[model samples]
Target chain A: MLASIVNPLILGISIGSILLISALGLAVIYGAAGVINMAHGEFIMLGAYSTYTLQSTMGMPFLLCIPCAFFIVGIIGFVIERNLICYLYNRPLDTLLATWGVSLVLMQSSRLIFGSDVKYIAMPEFLSTNLELGILNFSTFRLFLIAVALILLFITWFIFYRTRLGIKIRAVTQNKEMAASFGINAAQVYSITFAFGAGLAGAAGAMFGALSIVLPTMGMHYVVEAFLMVVTGGGSILGTVFASTLAGEIQSIFAFIFNDTMARGLLFILIVVLLRFRPQGLLSTGSGRR
Target chain B: MSFTRRKFLNTAALSSLALAAPNLWLPGAQAATSLKADSPIKVGLLFSLTGSLAVPEEDSTLVMQYAIDEINAAGGVKGMPIEPVIVDAKSDFKVYSAKTKEMILRDKVISIFGCYTSASRKAILPTVMQQDNLLFYPTCYEGAECTQNCIGTGPLANQHSFDLIPFMVDNFGPKVFFVGSNYVWPKESNKNAKVWLERSGGELLGEEYIPLGSSEFGPVIEKIRAAKPDFIFSTVVGASDIAFHRQFKQAGLKVDKMPIASLTTGEIETAAMGAEYGAGHFLSAPYFQTIETPTNEKFVDGFLSSPYGKNGYTHYNMEETYLSAYVFKNALEKAIDMHGVTDVTPRKIRDAAAGVKVEADVSPEGLVWIDGDNFNTWLKPKIGQCQADGSFKVIKEAADHVAPDPFSIYPDSGKCTADGLLGLDGKLKVDLI
Candidate 1:
């Protein structure tokens, strides 16, 4: 009984970590720009596809493909932001619709190129093995995911709190006019922030593609959870981390008690209830509206 | 007002000419004579060409085209060319219903062949029945439904589970666990599976359902480990299947120790996962790509060489869809032969569609025919182990074609109970009531 209880808890933590990594990018972009990027998931999809192409065509190592995916998706995101998203800034509704349109185009483009067939990236042999702890056994790939999530969280935190770019981004996010008055180029800051967020999504995608099937529409699967995490976390980096971990643990526990379907249903209900109480979310940064 | 005799005579003559003019305008005799032998019989081809299901359903469309090409090449259906009116459902059920209705009412298609999923079929079923049209649906599904207007050219749950459960018990162990996508097909199929488990003296350890499109299987994997079931029976479909297999393999669960037996895994899934991760998983289906026969070889070669088969992965659903076309063609020819060309209607063709035997050569599978009673096809179920080359190696096959039992009423002892054992409260209580 103890083993059963402990195993699901561990699994839940792992799940939460994955959700955290996937949602971090959305939170960063949405919180900073107040642009609900509907295409964030597609960015992740592009990252996964990039990893697949690199590994298959160029025989690139799986480890190397992670950064490569980030860079590739980051460049794509930068271009999209400059050409499309920049025009719709401050117009949230238009931005949402535009991003959605971009997502559809990306999905169709991928289908045309990849032919709608599912693809998989082979993980390293060592990572494929399970780590059998006393009464708790989990896959190393999941452990790696958790570790990556932690590393990414730290990196994101360091960037925001410790780096110069982080200060510029936060300034622009908090008061764009004030930051511009202070001689900070808010446009460049927004562009860099969007690209960085997309790069994070790309990294998440690389991890996810290894974990699941890579298809044209695979982004939709992760995007929902990512959005939930962002909304529940109140669209902040630290808040998202907390929300995802809580959500993941709750889901696993509920699933363990009931079933997977019921767990998901219950999770949604809980999120709704939480939102009903705290409309601003678990942690409100107030960076969204302005 | 009519005073003169000449005026009255002219009025009578004009009235007679008006009556004669109606007859002259009506093409009653000419219409019959104008029945041209070269006219094409329009058939609606409805399947998802875009969206999530496009990957698998696209192949079904290709197979339909392949069948149409072959039939037309061989002097058409009774020398009248088959004009395919194709439409993409886009993986939406509402769209499926609208398309089916439009094809029947607007295009006046003689018959329609499409729908890969049960949901889409159910959506279009009402329209097909109400419109009194024939729909040839070709995909193995959780069957208890029998509709006269719709002909199922795929195996039912009974045909697959009856053969599959026993085979797993005999070769693997009596202990089993079940996992599937949360849907009607998986839920109903698992219910039947529970019945089969009891009949074979096998014990069901646990059963769980993940939401459709769920990628995470960590908690479920842990649960399976704790239960220590001898084998897993997975009905998880689409992207979820890929996730489950990859996770199962990555978690170092050896197939030899506890292999997975699936109803949904096929050539496409195997290819997607590739041999390294996918091999050793067991699948039970009516058709496999690796079937070695002269006819199958030719069909496979022809399809692969065709432009539509560039992907080089022909799934069981594709073959089933291909077989549906031939079944429709055979029934169409029979209907035309029975009722002369002018007298043929949807009802007449549907009546003739019963027990339509498709020769072994036309289908990759051998000796497929529709059962007149259930409207499901009589299929030979085969157990295949995935090979490294993204193909199935037939480990076992049924001795003969298993008759379709959509209701599973036959072999009354094997009848499924209402309890699907889907409750998540605890492990399944396998004691037979």
Candidate 2:
């Protein structure tokens, strides 16, 4: 019984870490930019496809493809923001609609290019093996994902708290007009932030694609969980991390007790109830209201 | 204009008439003789061309077109060519239902051929029944359903799992774990599996279901490890199947140690998931591309030479789709001969479809014949193990055709019902040759 409980707990931690990594970019963009970017999932999909293309066509190593995917999707996101999202930022509803439309366009374009077939990325042999410790057996790729999630969290924290660029971005996010008056280029900060968030999504996509088969519609599968984590976490990076961990643990425990379907149903109901009590989320950064 | 009773009635009548205009324009009662002999006989191709299921459904569409081309090349079906009105369902059930109605009422297609998922088939069933149209469903699915308006041209679960479960038990160990996506096909197939496994004296270790399109299998794999089942019986379909196989391989579970026997995995999946991930996996189907027969050789060669075949590899679903189109053509010819050209309706075609047989020489799969009562086909069962090259090496095959038992009544009750028809207890009366 104890072994059973311990195994699920470890599994929960791994799943929570995955959720945190995937939702990190969405949290960053929503928290900092105050724009509900509906195309976030598609950006992640683009990252996976980029990794697939690079690894399959160019013979790039799996590890190298992750970062390459980041830059490719990040640049695409940067251009999209510069041209489209930048214009609709003031109107959040319009931004939501525009981003949703952009997501559809991206999904269809991917279908057209990839021919709606499943593609796979080969992981390194070491990552494919399992790490067995007594009663607990975990996948090495999942362990790698957890480690990457931690590193990402640290990097995000360092950027927001330690760097000058982070400070400027934060200032802009707090009050764009005031930051502009103080000589910070708020538009540039927004663009860079959007690009960084997209890069994070790309990184998530690379990991996820390696975890599963990459397809044109792969984004839709992960986007729901990403949105749930972001919304539950209140759009703040720290909040998202906390919420993902909590939700993951709760879901895993519930699944262990009942079943996966029931656990997910219960989890959704619990989230609704939690949202009813805390409409602003678990932790809201008092900015981006306007 | 605001509150007059006569004006209100007029407006309501006009709106109702506008809403009913589309249905009123339906040419349902039109005679087949009205179609010119030179003009093509319109048939609806309602397979999903886009969305999650497009990978498999695209093959069905391609094979259907190939069959039409084959028939057209042979001086047409009695000199009347078949023109397919293709519509993409986009992997949505509502879209399938809508398209079925549109094809029947507006396009006035005589028969439809398509639907990969059972949900999509079930969604369009009501529309097909209400419109009195015929549908040739070409994918193997969970059975126990027999409808007059549709004919399933693929093996049912009994034809697949009954022979497979005992084979696995005899060769492999008895302890089995079943996993599948949380859906009708998987759930129903697993239910049939449990019965067959128990009958074969195999012990079921555990059963689990993950939501469709779930990427994470870490917890499930851990659970399977704890259970230590001899082999996994997987009914997991679509994207989840790829994820499970990849993760299972990544976890260093050797296929030789504990192989997965599946009803769904075939050439298309093996090709997509790569040979390494699927090597040594087992699959049960009526057809495989690697099956060496002169007919299959010609079919594969013809397909490979064609433009549609260049898109991707052919699988069991594609073969079934190809077979279904031929079956429909045979039935249509018989119907046109029995009933005059003017009287060729869905009912006539369905009536003539009874006992319609495609001989071994023409069909890629040895011999296939439609059972009129159950609307399922008699197909020879073959169990194969996947090799490194994304093709199956047939390990076991039935000596003769296994009759379709969608309800699995033969195994449940030990009575032989000579003909290939259902007995009193909703079971197939097994005929001993």
Candidate 3:
């Protein structure tokens, strides 16, 4: 009987690991720029595709290819921002539409080049095994995912809190004009910030690809969930982590208790109520929006 | 050695008798007894190759190719070679509908084969029904649907649930718990399952449902443990199903004591779950990738050699899609022979299919026949259990080659049950005392 609770909880944590990695990047972008990066998930797709191409075409081992995937997606993100995003600063809604367009283009390109077939990454040796602690069963890869996410999150948190660049970025986010007057070079900062967010998403994509089947439209499917995370977690980084873990647990528990449709419907209702009561997410600022 | 003998006999027969496949020849060329065989027959392969269903869709597409190659290598199907026109539905229901229409109307395919999920099937149905085109649906699904123009090559509910209930009742002694993803499909499946479970002298400990793609299975598993049913009848679907199964195993539940007999969990899904998590699953599908036979061996060999096949994507729906090509071919040949039709008209091809009895080597069952109602009899469900080596072992048979009773009574349709599970007929097979 105790096994029952521990099993679902472990599974929830595994799923949460994936969600947190994927959502953290989107959350960072939105938190920093207040620009809802709709194409955030696309960066992950690009990363996955990069890994796919490297593995299938170049015959590179996946271990050697992970960083390559990250860098390639980072470059793509940087390129996209430098070319398209720089023109639309201060226009959040337009940025949303523009990023949405970018997402469509990326998805279409994947279909065109890859023929829309499902592609998979050879799961690493460590990923395909399980670990047990007493009665609690856990997947090694999922635990590894949590470890990677925590490291990246810490690095990002440290960069945002301790660095001179971090202060400048916050200044730009809070007041771009003032930051510009202070000679902070907010434009370059925004560009790097966007690329940095994209890289994290790329890393998430690389990890997710190894764990699950990769397809062209997987990005859009994840984008919705990421949006949910950003909305539910709001602008608070700590809150995002809390909500991410909470949402994962709630979804898992509800799924365990009821039929999937009812569980999801109930969760949607719960989120709505959460929004009404808190006006943001459960851990978000009041009237918090994605 | 037996296979070698069979091949030898085939070669000897080919040389001794200048047998012409009359069905494969063109009208004017039939007088010559033998015909030319250079031009390949191009058939379109459509599946949700992207998005949500892409995993299974890719599996099916690869399997389809494997089957086509296997058939063609054996001197082609009825002396006509095959060419695959592949398209991806991208897991969009609209794409399935529109692209299928385009394949039939504009591309003028000989026959169309693809699609695994219900959403894709439903989206593709109206277009096929309206156009009266031929489609071979290759997935185990709810039984309420029937299309005269389509042959459901996968097991329907009656073929699966009715037989399963009896088998479980005899083996486990009539105690069950029905768990499913709550939707039209599972609800309908549960209703049918209850009727059978009660009739088979079994007790339903509990029935529960969850949303589609749900990840948790704790609360339900706890309740199940409390009820202590002999086995679980599950119909969970998608990625979340993976999470549930993983969690179920993680929870330290006694799987050996209570096996999960599921509708949605099949060879395709097991491969997706990967070997580490896929063990201990017992499932039933119309066909499985691991059935040992010449046809299946050839199918497996071809898949293992292919790009996607190397990764162990031998899924149920994928193999079904692969077998469906042969089904379409057999039907078309019969139609053309019977009607001298060359245009690939839907009515003509469908009529031809009704006349043909196709035998694909890789079928879980040895043979399949299409009934006059456009329902296939050969697509019988085969029981499988996941083994350590990333494959399902065919442990048993569901029926003596079950034929779909398309005209069975539906509660919504006011149709009564067909041949009863209580005795032979479905009528008078109520759950009441």
Separate DockQ for every predicted complex: 0.60, 0.62, 0.23
Expressed as tens digits, the lDDT of each residue in B110-164 for candidate 3 is 5678777666777777666655565778766666654555666776677778677
Fraction of real interface contacts that model 1 preserves: 0.74
In Å, residue A117's CA in model 1 sits off its true spot by 1.7
Against the native chain B, each candidate's TM-score is 0.86, 0.89, 0.80
* Clashes per model (N, Cα, C within 3 A): 0, 1, 23
Which of the two, 1 or 3, has more lDDT?
1
Residue B4 C-alpha lDDT in model 3:
90
- Kindly provide the TM-score obtained by chain B of candidate 3 when compared with the true chain B: 0.80
**Local distance difference test scores for all models:** 0.84, 0.85, 0.70
TM-scores for all candidates? Answer: 0.91, 0.93, 0.76
lDDT of 3 by residue, A1-290 (tens): 68776766765665666678888888877888676888987888888888878887988987766678778888888898899988887788899999999998998888778765456566556555567787566656667777887887897899899999899887887778888998989889988888888888888788766665566766765777777777887666677787777777776677666644455677778878888887667565442233
| Candidate 2 local lDDT, B1-433, one digit each (tens) | 3779998899899999999786866554442222344568889999988998898898888889998999899978889899999999999988999998888777878899989888888888877766768889898987766566778899888788977899898888999999999989888888888898989999998888999989777667767777888899999988889889988987767788789999988997887777888999999998998889999999999998998886656788899999888888899889888876766888678768888998888789788999866667898989999998888999999888887777673444333222333545776532211
| Best of the candidates, DockQ | 2
